[model samples]
Target: MASNGLLRECVQQLKSSKHDYEKVLGGSVEVVWQSVSSAIERHLRLKKGVGVPGLGKFSFIRDFQPLTPVFLLNDRFISSYGVSWKRPPPSLVIPIAELNMSVLGSEAGLPKDQVAQTLDAVCAFVGGRLQKGSASGRIPVGNVGFFQCEGKNLQFVFDPSFVKSLVQSSNDAKPNVKPAADPIKPTVQPNSVANRTSIAMTDAIGSISQLSLSRLVNEEPDSSSDKSSDQKNDKRDHHRHHKHKHRHSKSTPHLPLSTQSDTQTSTSTQSQQILPRFLMLDPLRAPPRHLTSDSKYARVQDSAYERETEDVKNRVARSAHEVEEIARRTKAAQLRYLQTKAEKSVLEREMNAFLHGQMEFKRNAKQQEDARRSSAMEYDAVKILPRDPIVTAAQRREVKLKLRRRLNDQVALKDDLAKQKRAVDQAESAYFLSKLQLHAAHEQEERAERQRIEREALVAGWTQQLAVRAQHEQLHPTRKHR
Candidate 1:
């Protein structure tokens, strides 16, 4: 297998790919890469797949699988680039400092400590994967290949079948392929951006025009004008009628006597009289025009009286219901209390009876036992004494030895208990000491953290002041000389 380029070269290539997202992200190549790499790491941690545009997807697998990022190439990209893998994977070991420098672009802009931390995290993840895979003797590296442990050494086993299948499937799934260009087609110079934009605008206008023409062909003739004309004609006739009425009125006599008395009376009656005969009855009359006027004052008063009576009735009903509920609840509580009292009395009576019976039984048994003992003592007194008694010194000696051994064992047990007490005391003291140490350590850590924060703030303020001083010097360089 050919030797692969260093990580530096890889980072350079990545930076070159910055054109892919430069306009969209509006960030430098280093920033974009950092964001992308962090996102990839985050996705891997969550066991989700991360996709790099125009490149491939990196996925994480669960279970006994190797903790490696799986790179699945895009079919179109693979075909365009004519990508192929070597049989043996090349070594990718690089110093943490170098990798951090490459990734961050500048040490002055980004802290080395932060870079080092990030590099450590990445290395830890990779090492974890290596360890997990080494356990199973096989670690899969997505579409590229896999690593297998052979004895003490690890070796890469390349397999291009999976990648090839992915490409084939993608090619099959893609639709609407344009016709292939001629093999010997003449090369055309690329147009300027402005010219291309203008051409696109012209095409868009032409398509819009064609669409409008098609709509015009399909649309029915508009009848809006005819309706508008009729409306105008009606308006004109209305205006003329209004003008004629105004002139006629001015020409007519104004005297009430000039009008017919019968017509005037008929209009007055019609305006004053109710429309429905039923409405003439007070109970069935239409609602009064003025609720508080003299004409409807009696009705309003009656309504108020009725409302008051209803309110009184509702109050009485509510009070009665509330009284009944309270009485019912009180009665129920009293009944429950009586029932419980009765049960308690019954239980107490039964308990007293049981106790009395038990005491009588015990007294009788005790008397019977005393009588049996007296009978046995009388029988023993009447029995004849043994002719001879055997004496054994060994039995007496054994009894004394057993008693002495028991005493010695008791003494040893007490001594052992005292030792245990001393051990417990020592353990308690040690525990107290440890607790004090832990508390002191915690306090020290907190103080250190606070001091570090204060230091960082002070440093930031100093840097800002320095920056301001530099700016002032730049703006007023000749002031000192003057």
Candidate 2:
């Protein structure tokens, strides 16, 4: 988050410029702003100033309490000359600001403190967030219009060019659109999915409202948590199988055992139908005779047109009937497929359980035969269990040597543990420092980027000022017309 003092500067300049030229008169006396009545007389007498062959005229107009200069910068007059002043409608400002906030990287690039500061700066006197979002700055001067960015960038738009371009669409007539403030930065990265989607409760789902945003953020399942449950299910499945086998093995003379259940399906848990909400509108009462001025033309056209309409409607009905029949057939086929699948699953489950029983039968028989052979061998030979490797080595070692080695290994193990602990502590410290450094560097980069943009803006502003002054000189009386 970075910003500048230009918005305030623009307002101050506007006020000063207006204050300097409220009234212009012949030399030798203080020229006062005319009284309300006198000003009306002067204004009524003043025609649009004539233009030179290559340069445009300059005029003065008032907005709020300030009288400001309007230049015909584009030859006829600067785009500013044609403004018919009115308080901008609420509809326009609100939507414009919303669009800008969305475009300016989801307000995340700006720190909370800085965002509040900017909001306060632009919204100080009037206009509020809407104008702040739309205007770049609240103060609009006459012809020499300026826009401000958070120390990020600033721009002066020839309001006229914008209007002309907008007009060249539709009827090819651009509306009188106001100039705008400029970019947050030169390389203002659009808010990424990570950032944009990060706007938890009120992110823009674009056309979707805040309610939808709430649903999207809140509706997502915790995927990591889901993975944990899957692991638990695997363990549970083993446990379940163990119990099933143990209980079956103990039973033979009692009631017969039934097979386990079929595998559950996804559709079993979630049932939803995607049906459209169909609506039909009823016809309203016909209008009075005066609403139909051309009775004869209507009468002649109505018959043919009505027949054509009816024919089209009938054709549509037939097509709809065909579609309905196809849909009905498809639904029946789907139902049959589902039923056949259910039957197949049941059969598979039973078959698997039967196989398991057969495997247990063979396994039990083999174990009994092995147990009998082991018992017969035990009568002839004494059984000695195999010793662990460490115990066997200890049997051959001197007690003194074994004790020393044991003590040494204990010391080594402690040292190893200590080393591991230190390594872990260092890792933790490094991780924390790296996180802090990364965050600090990110903020620094953000600041530098913003500053770079501001510098670019200042440069552009200087260029525009030179161009405007050149244009003004072209209209100078002492200089020959270009």
Candidate 3:
């Protein structure tokens, strides 16, 4: 119960610190609690104790009583001594968060958020690894302990050598100082039981001897007459006997009935005074009895019954509250699920429309590319002729008809060359157009590839989310109606 209280306190501290932690660790309180609890479990399993700088240590102690030789002698003896082989409950020391955030931040050599992220990552890794290895029995972790899984729970068994080493180290650290001397009196062997008993006996004997000598000195002188002497002796003996018996009764008030009766009879019968002697004797006494009123017992019983009833009522109330909380959360989760489903559908529709537009654009680009190629082919098929020099005139003057024919020939050649130049320009324009179309197609392909990648990423993210939701539901299943 104390451990549970401490764990709850620890969880609360971690939850409060989440605001100052990284976004990666800014999950629900339950997630943080689970992560922390798992981390603590793993730490205890790996090392007997885990020390987190600025956050105190979480230590595990095994609770068991070793069996002695006497207990091992027989089953009856073992049972009589209450020796048990059943596993003892674990003892855990949960750390309290007392150090300031600044101290942790400084120790980590990073900002608070980054430190939180690092710690979270470490916890997740360790916890996940341990959980995965849980099926294997007694996996050794360093030299401290072996981690074992009992059904679903993890357990740690400390190594005897490690424990011994720790104990030895602690003992070596302590100062060795001689004990102080006794103040009253010095004895040869002060620590020995025999010496103490002998010293007590000697002191008691000396006191008795002193009392006897004092009594002898205080006695009145004996009478000269035989009758008077006898009477004085008898009176003195009687006085001494009564005094001794009174002192004995006072010293042992709770003597048994039989012992008391025997002592009384013996005192009445004895006429001679017995000298006081020191004798070690165990007193025969009964244990004290207690008497309680019936009404008081009845009241106590009533109070216990009332307490039990109240506890039951509180448990029922808590159970009802938990059920209500679970139901509310489930409903909220369902609503969110519906909202996400709607969003996913809308995204899918948008993606499909975008892909259709891209396909249409690619088709137009292909058509333009084809048209440019056709024009280029046509230009390649055309032939261009070199321009001819104008015919030189003869030395003598020529006839008018002959000069007209030569001018006409020159004009025709010029016309043919101009047409050829026009054709060449058209071919060059077509070449440029084809190159532009090719570039546009390459851009469209790149854009399509990027969109495909984006779509895949979106789908993968949705799949991961769904998987997580399913796993969560599996872990904390709700009651199903028939």
Candidate 4:
């Protein structure tokens, strides 16, 4: 089930209880559920498991086969079989109603309502801590494990010691029962007595079959030779019967020797070809003694060993391929990085050149502006100076016209310089804005590139870990026996 469904159930339960949680939890049932769910999600993103005093521990377990996260009830929860202390398989569904809140509250010396309120308070506290920690970018690690957030998702890596402790606890909780013996040996032991026995049996069977076939092929039709062969076969049969009787007597001392011999004779008379003694014994009634040390058994062992060896080889080859792929990607990333760096350098140089040119243009404009101001001051002084008494009216009028024309030219030049200055100011502002935008874009690209690199590195690390685990399993395969 999804977490939302679980939260909905909690909300329904709270509403059915008809408690005024608004005062204690500061919300109605739906709001409280939302707050609790949000708190749980945030906490789980930062820790392995979140525990409630009167409720079960909530955890997310990554299934080995699927490698997908499964919601789990880690404590104070029972499986479908109603076994409370057993370590159940990871599951999505949980029986929330099975929790004995009253008993738990009594054990804690608090009322049920208070216990519920306490749970709410805990959720609030965790939410507050997470918000504070996220703002500071320094989330504290939990005892079992911690989470690393990547964008909107969280990646969890469990501690080895914590996993070991969980394993130990599960083992301790299991009932002590002796393991049953395997009917067939799953592993091969080349130097074992069972292997030697199987080898000898195979050789004997081959030799016996070859001798029987050769005798049938090379038979003579002469009456004297036939009689002689019959006599020899009779003697051989008697000797085999005696040997079988002796062995059975030694194996089954409870049975009388006479009865064993009579049964062996009856079996011998019924079959033309004598089967192996192991074939006569019922597999279900007796332990397989020689049956387990036969050619078929040896073949099974050999095939299992071959398969295991092949699997190991395949894993090693896969690991090598992954490493090569990672290396190739790393090289490609380095090339891209170098190219980006070169482009960035070129852009910086161009920007610097543009800014330098703008500064020079502004400096030349200023110098022209100063020269214009100085010429205006000189014209003002000329206008203010006293006139000569001997000068004629026509000369004075011509001089006045010349002065007015010069002043008009100076005013127009000053207006043009002001317009040029305003245009330069606008250009400078645009250039700075573009530069800021380019810088922001570059930073965003770099961040994206960094996140990609980190993701690749994490994948490579996981691949390496899998390879190491495969190698470790190959080296210590006997651990599985334990």
What is the RMSD, in Å, between candidate 2 and the native fold over all Cα?
A: 61.6
Off by over 4 Å in 3: 1-117, 128-159, 169-482
Q: What C-alpha lDDT values do all the predictions have?
A: 0.48, 0.40, 0.48, 0.50
- Residue-pair clash count for candidate 4: 0
> What is candidate 4's lDDT per residue for 113-232, written digit by digit as tens?
765775655333333433334311112133334333323222334455655655565456558746853543233245755445545545444433432222222222457645765876
**Per-residue alpha-carbon lDDT of model 1 for 1-482, expressed as tens digits?**
22222223333543455465322222233343454455554444444565644444555332212233344444343333223312122121111111234334352244444444434333232234333343224434334455453332334444556445544554665587667655443222235443344344444434323322122222232366456557768978888646544445743354233134324544543553312332222322424433333335445444554554455456545544554565568668966876786677567546755765687699899999888877844665476868876769998899999999999999999999999999999999999999999999999999999999999999999999999999998999998568
Each model's total of backbone clashes: 0, 10, 0, 0
Question: Where does candidate 3 clash, by residue pair?
Answer: none
Task: Return the lDDT, model 4, position 22.
Answer: 34
Ranking of predictions according to TM-score? 4, 3, 1, 2
Which tens-of-lDDT digit does each residue in 1-482 have in candidate 2? 11223344434533444444211111101111012112222322242222212222234342211222243332122111221122111110101011122222232443333333333333232223222333334233222232232221223233554234323432333266445424421221235332232232122221122111111112223465467558768878878646555445754443222112101111221231111112111112323334333455345434443454455456545544554565568668966876786677567546755765687699899999888887854655566799866656556677779899999999999999999999999999999999999999999999999999999999999999999888878779576553
**If both were scored by lDDT, which would come out higher, candidate 3 or candidate 4?**
4
Name the regions of candidate 1 deviating beyond 4 angstroms.
1-295, 375-384, 387-482
How much does candidate 1 score in TM-score? 0.19
| TM-score, cand. 4 | 0.22
By lDDT, is 1 or 4 better? 4
Worst 10 residues of 1 by lDDT: 89-98
Between prediction 1 and prediction 2, the one with superior TM-score is 1
lDDT of 3 by residue, 1-482 (tens): 01223223334555556465533343333333333444444544443444543222445343222210000012232222222222232232333232233444554444555555545443343344333443323333345544443333344455677566655554565578467645433323455554455445454444433332222222233244446547658978888646555545666566544446546644532432222222111123211223122345335534554554455456545544554565568668966876786677567546755765687699899999888877854777577999986665652346666888899999999999999999999999999999999999999999999999999999999999999988877877763221
The per-residue C-alpha lDDT of model 2 at residue 99 equals 14
What TM-score would each prediction reach against the true structure?
0.19, 0.18, 0.20, 0.22
Residue 432's lDDT in candidate 4: 100
